[model samples]
Target chain A: MQPNKITGIGLLTAAGVGCEENYCNFTARNSGICKVTRFELPTAKVKTDFAGLIKSLPNEALPPELLQMLNSDDLAQDYVKAAVYVTAEAIKDAGAAEKISSDPRRTGLIVASSLGNFLNVSELVKDYFMKELYKITSLIHGMNSYLPSRLGSMFGVAGPCYFVSSSCTSALNAILQADTLIKSGIVDRMLVCAVDVCLETGTFHLWNKIRVLSHRNESPQTACRPYCKTRDGIVVSEAAGCFVIERADAVGARGHATIRGIGMANGASDFLKPSPELLEAAIREALALAQTPSDKIDFIAGSASGSPHCDHMESEAICRIFGARAREIPLFPYKSFLGSTFGTQALSEGAFAIKTMNDNLVPEPLNIFERDERVAANAYYKAADYSSYHINNTLFVNYGFAGNHMAVVLEKC
Target chain B: MSKPKITREELIEKIVAAIKKVSGISIAPEKYGDNLFALGLDSIKAIQVVNMLEDELDLMIDDAHLPKFTSINAIAAHFDSLNK
Candidate 1:
């Protein structure tokens, strides 16, 4: 079977809403990192409270029909609201809403999340002791699959609907699943949405406890300085990236990008530390599957989220895979502008890759004042305008917790 | 200690509310005696109703009694027997 194509995309991030808004902000080099205003974290407990939080999208961010469907109650739940908004936008963008609604059984949905409704789980725990105040709302919120299942119901998708959670690589893995489903003829079209809302009190506290988050509260703008010598750690953020993926030959299809290759591997090493060996293997596997030479990869959407150890590991993997060409490829550190969005960041990067390819412009990585000599020092990090270069294929790499490495090759369709 | 007594009308009202709360399907007054399946309550929705009722009333409904929970009236009778 021919490779599947991403026909439509919906994006909601701290930077902006929808595809056009986000691409414009990204090309303008605007950073979405900002002060945490959603929840008041006690200053004494952590070094910084800065995060990329979309408390709620403005009414103008959504179409009038979508706006009417969403009420204040729905908007209050961050993940639920984000999932619905992005899915609707994606379906509308693909013009698949009516098609799917008419033939519900042909469409499926897969949602990915690293942490699903931490606030609801916290409430459920509390309500466990006080049964009188208990509500079944937690059931809807706490289940990661609930996001896709609800979207399936709302959008009239009667086919396979589920969730994938593999630490931070959840989104890419979910996308991979969509690719498989299409190739195997299980579903003609799949709606994939990856969302993570870590701004909630409980989830934020746990992330801080892990000490992998940046503590540069003083400079929130530069908090996520990926691959910089002075970089502290990742700045946790929230985002949702939804896509309408279908077979390339489908009727009325306008593919934004074709997924050429998808490679996934488990390092089976440390639970927290990433393994460079396995990551390099995953990249090579993707390149082989794509049937493209390493030199043909025009650019790489790097997943360096500023963690000292992980950045070094990712750099090592890049150097190993690309060898001498590693220093020449234009590698854009997406997390620098978007922050570490966990499971959703990869899908968000995929969106950026498609947009940049369409525009034929490579934006510079943000906040990398001093490149770390220890991590991919020779790697290229320069802006490329249309006159200087042309992008045909982009590589998106993501290394998740518990040693999960995922890579995908997206070619311009 | 004795279980607090609940009237049949009150039980039916709570059941109706629980059904609406879990499934978002309002139960008409005349449908109180109708089978929950006929009223559009699936197994999952029925269990959710049971869970909500259990929490609200602080009652430990038996597993065997689940089949009897087909209608609002049947659930009220089971709860009444437990209370007695």
Candidate 2:
């Protein structure tokens, strides 16, 4: 099978918007997290009222149908608009937007969103019980596949259109699906976009009730202390990261970054908390599929989302695989820079890694500080100026609830 | 191609206004027979039209009857028949 490559990318995160802008903000180490001011919550006792809230939605930059949804009062409507905007941007970046999705029969659309417009669904349920009102559109909009289906209609992608909700690993799993399709000769092109805006009152209210969210809401700036021993909890962010992946031969000389190998495995023993052994196996699986050695990998994208439970286990996993060399290979953890964008953070990390590798610069990460001793030894030394390294392959690993794990190896083309 | 009947003229007017309010499209009365789908009305926008009609006419439309709201003339005739 021909190798698959990321020809185009479109991103809307707390980091920034669009391909160039998102990459620029990443390299500049700009923090996208801020105080939540869009809507007020009366459920008052929460520690921090701040988050990586995206206030600037480019409605004018989107297509008409998507723009209509974005302007609506329902928070869930933004899902459709965000997906379209990023997907369009990715297609444009690949230099395919002018004649994008032209072959409906050859392209597939898949989005990974867990809540699937939870705010609107909550509002609809409330409307039904309180006011005895039932709307047909509400019934359809409540489905998880509804948002991606809108994208399927908008882009005329006649191939399979679906949604994947595997907790934090959702987006990476979606990418794995696209890779499978391309390698198995199912489709030539795939448009994969992951969008989640659950920061809506209903969802975040529940998260606050559970107290898993960072209590650092007061200071959105340092709320997310990623990969550090002082880390407390994760900060939830709203974003949509998109990419148009195509067979490398199709793009030929125009290739952006090659997707070398992808690996996904379930927990062997533990049901919830992470297993360092399982994570190590996942990384080894990816390297095996990519036909690359551990020593050959230049850097590793650590999946430290301010969750110490994840950090310790993942650190052990790295040590198990790389041994003494684990301390030498630079590790770039994600959450410190953009909070935790749930499953879609996988795509954002992929985008950031691609840009940094292309520019041959490892820009300092925001909110990323002194790492716990285990990761400190292997940490990518944060520098003010771009430092040169023999970077070729980068590994991206993301863990989900229920011990689901995914590791993707991205190689510079 | 035939002209709309004089009796259904008022219902047609309200239906046109309702479509405009729901979908933001201002169509001339001559396009009364045109397909709503052809006029850029999606399932969501079409459902929005149903909602506005229910509020304006003070009648609850059956879920099964929603498909009849295809064009200005169709909606007017459907409401007229329901009024019988």
Candidate 3:
């Protein structure tokens, strides 16, 4: 059950830049949702009004050399910038920057983004189709594959590098792959980074057309009511989380997180429609991998981000796994504070879980005015239940589009 | 193909404009001597600058030659050798 340890973590969310800022924001419990100001929303067309869109990390937050390279890549997509920022932060946080800087063979890179350079796709389409002689290369820069390869090239990590796209579960999948590589002795260290700059005109409208995004336009902050009776649907966001992971036996890391168990599955569930059976199966597999039972899980974390079906299915799955004991475990759907960041949700949630588990602070549920009737019966969490609580063994479950389900177990070492 | 960008000044204009277009940064005509990276130039923007220059001027700027062309002055120098 022992796996590679997560030495360093760098998170960039609407909560703010850096791990501490994100944790403070999560613990302080403030909503990062706002009406589209970074890019105007299609008020005339889509009902979805607001999203947590962050265009760039603060200049100070980005590594100086990486920032310069980004500014130089006039065509550098947001995904690339995010990947670079978090990768640098993680290496620095892990104190592995100097160690790995000398030996490219010791390290590898993995970057995941659900919708890679989606916003830039609009510009690319215009360049290719509209213009008589378009800049063809513009389209090439936005593709997903460039993300990790670029980071590897930048950091001189020659071990293994590529992209993983599994919709919302991408971050988990990235970490899962990193864990596999390390355990297999293929690489001693890995930079696992995931980003989704969700505010692209091309991609957002697609979600809007599908009507999965929230239309609580007037009240953007209270819009995404996950697991609440008044829940509507997901309020999209832009964010990224990066980690420096190494074999537990390899490095004396700063904050260590061993991958006790990880499981993922997919079935005949339709695209956009989550499969609860598959989710539960994934959780069971993860628990089995960790060699731990359900009763040992101190708390659970997931984003019941007002996707009624997903919330309902997740509730059923949790009840099935924990039974009446579910009432004793606190289900923290912290995305109620930050809008649902598509691919990086679980990673950001994992960051929160690490902070919560270490600090033993169970942050209050944000804006859960009234728990859903089904959630009330099966799970234990309410607005009134907000206060500091204990955390140890934690379970994180995430589902991507197209029935892609993932569950991971993290234990305090 | 696109009139073979005739002069270094002309090439610099295109490169500077490319920089502005790609990164949303505006460069002062006088700041050509300044390092573009120091002024917020990144790898993506560098590729864009190369792409724009290559396409418009019908000039082939090697990726290896990119680091040498760190500023407007440095890029103009590259264009100078290519032109000659």
Which candidate number would show the highest lDDT if scored against the true structure?
A: 1
Instruction: Give the Cα-based TM-score of candidate 1 against the true structure.
Output: 0.79
Candidate 3 lDDT, tens digit per residue, A296-406? 988788747787777888888988898887877888776777777888876777787777777776766666677677774234455345355556688988885767898
- Cα deviation at B11, candidate 3, in Å, is 61
Superposed model 2: Cα runs more than 4 Å off: A56-58, A64-76, A97-102, A268-272, A368-371, A384-386, B1-84
Q: Which pairs clash inside model 2?
A: A48-A217
Error of 2 at A367 (Å): 2.8
Query: Across residues A1-413, which tens digit of lDDT does each residue of candidate 1 receive?
Result: 68899988999888887777888888676657788877777665555688988657665656676567665645667777788778888888888878797878889999988886766677778777777566676666787766777778778899899999888899898999999998999889999999887576667766765556777888887888888888877888889989999988894447788899988888654466677888888898888888878889988888888877778888888888888878877777788888888889667878887888877788766788886888763334656443578889998898867778989999988
Model 3 achieves a DockQ score of 0.01
Q: Per model, how many backbone clashes are there?
A: 0, 1, 17
For candidate 3, the TM-score is 0.79
lDDT of each: 0.80, 0.74, 0.75
For each candidate, C-alpha RMSD in Å? 17.6, 20.0, 18.9
DockQ, 0 to 1 scale, candidate 2: 0.01
Docking class of 3: incorrect
Q: Which regions of candidate 3 deviate over 4 angstroms?
A: A58-61, A74-76, A252-254, A376-389, B1-84
Error of 1 at A117 (Å): 1.9
Candidate 2's error at B16, in angstroms? 65
